[model samples]
Target: MTRVVELVEHAPAVGVALPDAVGRALAAGDIVDAVPDPYVPGHWSLRAGSKVGAVAVATPGNDEPITVRVTPKVPITRLFFLLGYNLDPKGGWRDGEVDVTGHRDLLPALAHAVERQVDRALRQGLLQGYQRREETSLVVRGRIREADQIRRRFGATLPVEVEYDEFTTDIAENRLLRAAVERLLRLPGVPHDVRRRLLHQRARLVDVAVIVRGHPLPVWQSSRLNSRYQHALHLARVVLENASVEHAPGALRVDGFLFDMNKLFEDFVTVALREACRSFGHSARLQDPHHLDEASAIRMKPDLVLYGPSSAPCAVVDAKYKAEKREGFPDADLYQMLAYCTALGLREGHLVYAKGNAPHAAHRVRHAGIVIHQHALDLDQEPSGLLSEVDRVAAQLVNTPRV
Candidate 1:
């Protein structure tokens, strides 16, 4: 049996007694900060930040494994919506496409969603496509590499180095799906049924090669042929990119999947704002880079920058997962936005937060005359309402004077 410890995002730290090895591993994991209580013996205070997921560490001589499950402040459903929208804004995820009500935590919900998506993707059978192959073969096939024949083989005639495009089911799309299935199977706390389904999905992708760990994944392009696989592949990428496993001395192993709310919020806000801007004939650049200083020594990347018909940056915006101050947006954020406005020669800027003490506020820098607006977006609302809020923000940007 594995002992389960639960924590909430941005909540007060909780004290729990954990094995010394487990405690130290959690401290070093970067998902949470574990501080040993100075007054309490054998106890550690655990606090979670923006990252949320389940991490399990097993210690030597301990019969049971300890799993730390951090719950996100945003509802899991809405979080998935943000993630889905970010992954593919055009046609990736829709309301009720991924059902999360069945699972209690992130890991299980992710596993379930991934399995279902993969199953849907493979419903028509594994997609087969051409993959480039380069190898030495006894029989001559495709184009032969003469340089390699002279260098390594030394003009050997029997074995030839050839390159060819082989048509097979083991393409990048299937491999990504298989990799996500395997990743979910390895993580802690997946429901038994979901695990079994994931295994089935793996069996379907038996011919696909396992992606080499720590190497860049094989690239796949979106086309009409692979249109059915786009959603599954996107979700699969999320699994592979965010999950990790760590091995320590004394046979201790730590592994889990975590999603950073900050990044998620930023991605969602920028992408959504970009979509909204497009509807109004304005173009948006995500993470647009510019310099804050005259010498170009200080570099800055605003979350989203809107460009007018003349191809000049007319508006700048930054996304905050949550506001820093309890009364309103943080002063530091306002200061940063002012810098963005000043550097970009824009008269106004916007800061969007996931939530805040105030719904909206505007500050005018005394010397600069640059006005910074802070807007709070409630994540708990329906997807339509949330996007409507984004539309309102985009409307404001369109109404701002050209810089």
Candidate 2:
């Protein structure tokens, strides 16, 4: 006998129950959809949709009761498929036959899945493109591990080992996605510069981190990073826009490019921020442009704004990419970051400069109860080596009492 199960979201603890067939379909990562039918008695047809996250399966008829914990305010679509019986050619009904079961909600599910997939693809493409720009990058200084098992009659023994390699690839590909979109916009016969300018604007919209004491580094491609950026952009846009639409191929491509660019910027910032946090035993979030307060009115935006573990302001960072470091100090950069610290009620801020510039001494100044720091990012070392310097700097920040 086929069982009828009702899927519902529970309060306090949010989760969803999955049937055996549905679980299997999700695990297999099928492309689900609903289509109009003429020959069939039903008005609609049900099928698979695009894949996003990984899936796990449960044994059939076990009924152990499955539940999935979900993020609050995040909408998830659940699809139902028909299983159990069908009719035979000999005029007898067959038992335990599974086929497509129609659901009114399937259309929206398909749209959501496609949207996510497209976003993911675009982000991945961008990261891959950036990594391709440079090769032989330095690996971060951290232990890496993999697992192995030795089987015996009594029991299986699991063992693991660690290695330090020169390759540590974790940069996201959103930047590459932006590049692709710009390329498409610049394609011959497309007269609209608006699209091209929009693409450029999107490319410039990125979170940045400035490493103070690191060697020059190489760049590499990462598909995983690209996908993540794409998803983040999609979520951000969707939340900001508050709606969905049919899957447009051109729109998908454009979105993919934007997402990739966003991801690249995010990754770069994350690494630098992580290094700072690790050194100081603190953490930070990319500041939202919408949350700027009156104190920071003069300094509109900063590359990075760090926070203490208690959510207290730590430091403000601004990143610059220049082939040559300025003689003495960059006054404009210093003033801008100092303004951010003053506005955010922070005590210290930093100006991080890119590599290939003439090295200058670190500068410190106190203004309006805040200290502004100017340091250069050494791109001459590997990524890992550069991160080590970041960690040291963060540690110093934490050890030193706030002045």
Candidate 3:
């Protein structure tokens, strides 16, 4: 049996007698901060940051593995909603689509949801498409490579270098699905039933090529032909990108799937605001880069920059997720927004933050005429309410008078 240690996000550090090898592995993993307690011998103080998920590390001499699970401040359902909306704003994840009702942890919920989506995607049978192939064959096929055939097989006409398109089910879409399945299978703590279903899904994709570790995933374009795969592919991407796998020294292995709520909040704010304000005939850019100095050396990236029809930046916005629940807006954020306004030649800027103790407030720089507004978004609400808050912010952003 494995020993479990549960920690809540942004909670106070607690001392636990963790194995030296496990402590070193967790430190290297950066999933959480583990420090040797000075007062307590053979104990390490563990603290969870904004990241939340489970990480398991195998001890050297112990047969049972020790798992560290960090619970997110937001409910799992809301977290999934944020993840789903970020992955696909246009019908990628709906309320009833991937049911995560009974799941108490992130991994099981994510695994179960992915299996469901993949199963639905392959119900119509594996999608077949044309794949480009280049090889050396004894018999001439589609077209022989002229230069290669002469250079390599000089005076020999047996094996020819040829290139052709092969129609098969082993395409990028199926390959991505297979890769996600394989990833989940390797992870620990997946429910028995979910694992069984994932195996069945893998069997269906037996013909697809397995994605090599650390290699770039096969790319697929969205088209009417591949429309059925869009949902599964997006979710699959989340798994491949966010999960971490590390091999420590002394035969210690660490496997984890974590989500940085700060990044998630920023993504949701920027994406949702863009979509909410799209109907206003203006466009929004996420992580829009700009130079702060005349030398073009100093660079800055604002979370979102809205442009008017004339292609001029009309408004600037930044997203801040406060894990500390502090009382006021961080002065650094206001100064940063002020710099953005000065560089972009905008009079008003916006800072959107997760709901904190400080309510909506506006501050005007004394020397500069720029005014910065801080807006709070409550994550505990329903999807509709969260997006409604975004719409409110968007309206204010659009209505800011132009210079």
Candidate 4:
């Protein structure tokens, strides 16, 4: 699909009316009932009668413009906007506008554009959370002694002179080391060999050092060979300084150094899904504390559950960040998801893996007459390509006939 970008304005009160303008401009089929945001007090909700896709209303900022960009399931000529303006305090009025500016077909282009904006905003929000955690204060103490003398003494003697200087008290340093590592790992365009080497060597060392330091570590490197990785790590470190983990309740310990790979994968998937949903003119709501039942009396909580297009359950995607994909689907995974599907009454589920593997053919399995389709998402792909791939899969689900 060609990329789309859109910008529009609507009154907060009349924002709900913009959907109709979108439906008309895009010619999105039928008005399946609209669903409002249970969280937001006054938000818009509109569903196409044909169940093509969904749209979400973003929270407004201080006197900021209220706008939504719609990317359609199908390509269309012009992007339409149902703008709402506050005509009076009691209520507001909405009107539709078409942008025919500069050889740009507003509809689909605007859709992609709006999605990118929303995705950027959402990512910023997530990064902000990470930033907050990173901004934690680290108790650091420094003493001004002759650097050459200290180095010479340390170099010559096993036991170096140690002195506690009252003048240089403990200073709380803010460093974002972990966030830098994560950003480097997720950065696109870095060569695979380079990434692999960093992951195996530098990344592992940094992870260990972070544990040892009990605070974000400083990166001291002049080599151009791994500059990209180094730069990313630097940024991640900055983010880590503000992250919640930096201010963890207890004194940081080495044992707590164990990084939660699963949680990292989950966060990555959430970002991916948020971007994907935005591209489809829909917003995704994460269903937490997802309940699942199994015959073995063991309950499993999948990483994330997403609701798209009104309240309709769209997809269940699980994230697996392993060193490599196991040969042939793991039996345990299948069994576990089988139970999850049955419990949730879902016909299909997805398993997203971080490392790139030969794309697995979609599988169809039947349990109690419920056919569950399983697929794998390759995280190794370029960010834009990966998001586009997600869009394709979502469109297939929306258009394909269900068994």
Q: Each model's RMSD to truth, in Å?
A: 2.1, 25.2, 2.1, 23.4
**What tens digits encode model 2's per-residue C-alpha lDDT throughout 1-403?**
2232222111221123443344433333222232444454433333322211111223444544221111111122111100000111122111112111221222223233323333445443333232222221134223423231122212322222224433222233343333333333322222244344444444443331221212222232334534355433332332222111112232121011111112222344445555457545676555435235656453365556566776766666655543222464556666666566666666666655443332444545633566655555454454456556666555544533243
Off by over 4 Å in 4: 1-266, 285-287, 294-299, 322-330, 354-358, 378-381, 396-403
Q: After superposition, how far is residue 346 of candidate 4 from its true place, in Å?
A: 1.2
Question: Count of backbone clashes for each model?
Answer: 0, 33, 0, 36
Q: Which stretches of candidate 3 lie over 4 Å from their true place?
A: 323-330
For candidate 3, lDDT tens digit of each residue in 1-403? 8888999987899899987778877887888889988787779999998888787888667789988988887878998899889988977686588889788888899899999999989999999999999999989999998899999999589899999999999899999999999988887778899999999999999989999888998999999998888888988988888776546667897887887888999999999989988989889999998899999899999999998888889999999886233365547787888899999898899988888624689988887887899899989999999999999899999987554
**Which lDDT tens digits does candidate 1 get at residues 153-242?**
886796899989999998989989998898898899999999999999999999899997888987899999999899899889999988
Give the Å shift of residue 281 in candidate 4: 5.1
- Candidate 1 vs candidate 2: the lDDT winner is 1
Q: How big is the RMSD of model 4?
A: 23.4
Best to worst by lDDT, what's the order?
Answer: 1, 3, 4, 2
Which is better, 2 or 4, measured by lDDT?
4
Residue 31, model 1: Cα distance from true site in angstroms? 1.2
